[model samples]
Target: MGREFIDLFDKWATSYDAAVTGHDPQYRDVFENYDTILSEVVSNSEGNVLEFGVGTGNLSKKLLDADHHVIGIEPSKAMREAASAKYPDLTVLDGDFLSFPKLDIPIFTIVSTYAFHHLTDDEKGKAIKAFNEILPVNGKVVFADTVFESEETKQEIIDQAKDNGYNDLVYDLTTEYYPMKNTLQSLFKQNGFYVTFKQMNKFAWLIVAEKQ
Candidate 1:
């Protein structure tokens, strides 16, 4: 799954919150309206929630605060520990998008933020298919992450990041699993979902894919 990025996430555990809070200029735009975005994800989700990539549990806290029964799955041990430290009661499992402990309870909604890009397009398709199997009819997948309009537009953003000397950001854009709008639309539909996209920032889009 996304374990290939675990070392980076382990190293980033202490700084991840700061980075998302705009302390890192390289990622400022990517994390624009960070608080509002989390709130939007929380608002869009309902019932028992399974949150993949619960890095530092920021979004999990929001879900819990909203009185939702939430279960989080994270691959990085360090990230999982950090999230546990932040919220002792929350249960964050060791897993990724494609592989995780099977949940027994009925899950009505799945929510993730800024983390799904760890999986490639093929992996993403598999994840969506798995969601179809796990969720009830009309169940939703609410994710807010970086996505591009097209390959050309993605290249433009990467070029800008390079010009600004944000080499890490460039590397992330080039290496991570950020997908195009059409690609995601097709993935959701092929797996029996009705999807919608709302641009949340220059780099991020809110994707709501409901199981059909």
Candidate 2:
């Protein structure tokens, strides 16, 4: 959670989009669910949104296409540049989720995908609390990422990923601090968020947490 993290993304930014979107057919379902949930939330929400780990801005592009006001925060300069080039109208800042500067806006929704996993469990709770403080009543956090039922389930996913020719993804998953779905729900609820969850597939899920 330092320069190493930023450096990794900077190095991969050029190929990150294809590496993710074209990883495998199974990953297609992940993006579909992310877009579906994001579209549903954006359509229902009342104010603007702040997206963390905007990466190449695929999700923000969709949000912009739908006419939702969005500001993106990305720690990687290369990724931010790519996103900026793709959407010159977009506002992309340089910062990570745990360390982003506060924005002055009526943010009704916060969205992130596969980015929060960089934080440890305690940090995840802190991140959620920060979201609560920033959002007013009824604000929502739409989080979509890799989740598991248990350690065994996580290991199973790793095995399957390696078998499916996504060895790099498997390695990252194994090394990263991916949280269990139930644990994540508890963290959300503990931080004054009423939560709803939808499992997109075995390895991915979406959490919609409304501020109380």
Give the alpha-carbon lDDT of every model.
0.92, 0.78
lDDT of 1 by residue, 1-212 (tens): 47799988898899999999999999999999989999999999989999999999999999999999999999999999999999999999999989999887899999899888888899999999999999999999999999999999999998899999999999888788898899999999999999999898999889999998
lDDT tens string, model 2, 1-212?
23347776787688767645546464554454555655554554456988998888887888888788898999988989999998899999888777887787778889887788878888899889899998989998987777888989888777887788876576678677898878898999899999987776555677789999
The TM-score leader among the candidates is 1
Candidate 1 backbone collisions, by pair: none
Q: State residue 1's C-alpha deviation in candidate 2, in Å.
A: 7.1
Query: What local lDDT does model 1 show for residue 12?
Result: 82
Error of 1 at 182 (Å): 0.3
Q: For candidate 1, what is the TM-score? A: 0.98
> Candidate 2: worst 10 consecutive residues by lDDT?
26-35
The runs of at least 3 residues in candidate 2 whose Cα sits more than 4 Å from the true structure, single-residue gaps closed, are 1-3, 23-41
